[model samples]
Target: MDRRFANGTVNAAQTGSGPPLVLMHSLLSDRASFDRIVPTLSESFRVVVPELPGFGQSEAVSGGLAAVADRMAGAVDDLADGEDVIVLGNGYGGFVALQMAIRHPNIATRLVLADCGAAFSEPGREAFRAMAAASAAKGLAAITDVAMRRLFAPEFQQAHPDLMRDRREAFLKTDPGVFRAACEALAGLDLRPQLGQVKVPVLVVVGEYDEATPPPMSHELAAGLPQARLKIIAGCAHVPQLQAPQAFLSAVGDFLGRR
Candidate 1:
């Protein structure tokens, strides 16, 4: 069911019942990105899929990723009701979850960070900067293809034309300002220094073929975290949950099922 939290500052959909498991979507995608895995996951857990701040029905926040993270922390706290919850974030959402966990140490008991990293390589940072500039100058349309490429490999995109069309539409719907702001934030972001602050166990999963964040980034993220293990979803790119939901679920099931 659709619900609002943090006094309607956050909009989310909830399903099933058990320990709360919050799912955060990537910047290029919306809450629907988690649709494939939610039903299966909700069978054993209360699946809470939230549209990140500035996306969908959620209110926007300024002050870069830290501010965004703080806003989500509030919403997650409200959802937790004093009980620690588990958070699973994909791409941009992973960064938010990581920052939220850092800023609010007790917000989550565990984390599943997918297709994200603690810091971007110089080239990666440049890519964000360029995208932000191009999108701001031209509009999201100018970067729609680029964005889709980041999310899925060309071969995969060719194989699933309808999915690509839907994904492209989703990317185009993103608020240009929000997209640019997130890009700028990510361009300068470096979370490695604060990895020590996160005390919860983390399952870092990445697509073996992910070009956006890449497997190396996940490797670095897992290595830096206090307690983290890495999983590579074979033959998938970014958004493996969408591309290969079963493989994504299998990669995380054992860890997420732990008490």
Candidate 2:
């Protein structure tokens, strides 16, 4: 279920059979977030969701995002066979996915980005900076639902009453120092210019009403990649996999089925 590498421990769930598919969840989430989509993806391929370092039961590292991202890349490299891997990342994890692809070019094959927050116009840096400042000022323990309002629309936040609270608590549990360093990594990251170098088939997914990453960012990812496809989920906010599971599965299935 889990292993300790030179970098950090990666808690992974490996099931089904076929090509190995690596899953990276969004910020404030762990590997378990993929529980809903795993069944669908496992039908066609082996699904491996690695709980990134410093999140959940995985190892906690003091390294910034780049270091953690690098460690994540190594973890995948260790598990991957000679064949390229199909990596699926949602929201902020998309940045780590991009880092993986960029750092481990040979192992990263096809990519599936769901409500990706990176790989586009990035004000992500400033947001991360604010988070760092907030953590420094009030400590990570005090952060609340108010912290996540930036990610979801006010109406969506109201409709899904418990989601923000749960996520806020989840993030708050993280080590303040590590969380702040991660924010530093996020603040320094900007992948828009490097999108052209990603030489793999890509599927860019977005929720029409997603306030976090939005449609324009998805379009940027699709437009930049050499061989990329775009799919927009209607009437959905961020986390379409959770918001509209069946539709999310269909879109992913169609894309993977093509290859």
**Top candidate when judged by lDDT against the true structure:** 1
TM-scores across all candidates? Answer: 0.98, 0.85
Candidate 1 structure quality by residue, lDDT tens digits, 1-259? 9899988899999998889999999999999999899989999898999989999999999999999999999899898877769999999999999999999998999999999999999999999999999998999999888999999999999999999889998888899999999999999999999999999999999999999998999999999999999999999999999999999999999989932
- Worst lDDT run of 10 residues, candidate 1, spans 250-259
RMSD of 1: 1.0
- Candidate lDDT scores, in order, read 0.94, 0.73
Evaluate model 1: give its lDDT: 0.94
Residue-level lDDT of model 2, residues 63-176, one tens digit each, is: 566667787887778777566678888876777787677666775778888887453344656666777897799886555443465456677777877866666666676667
After superposition on all C-alphas, the RMSD of every candidate to the true structure, in Å, is 1.0, 2.8
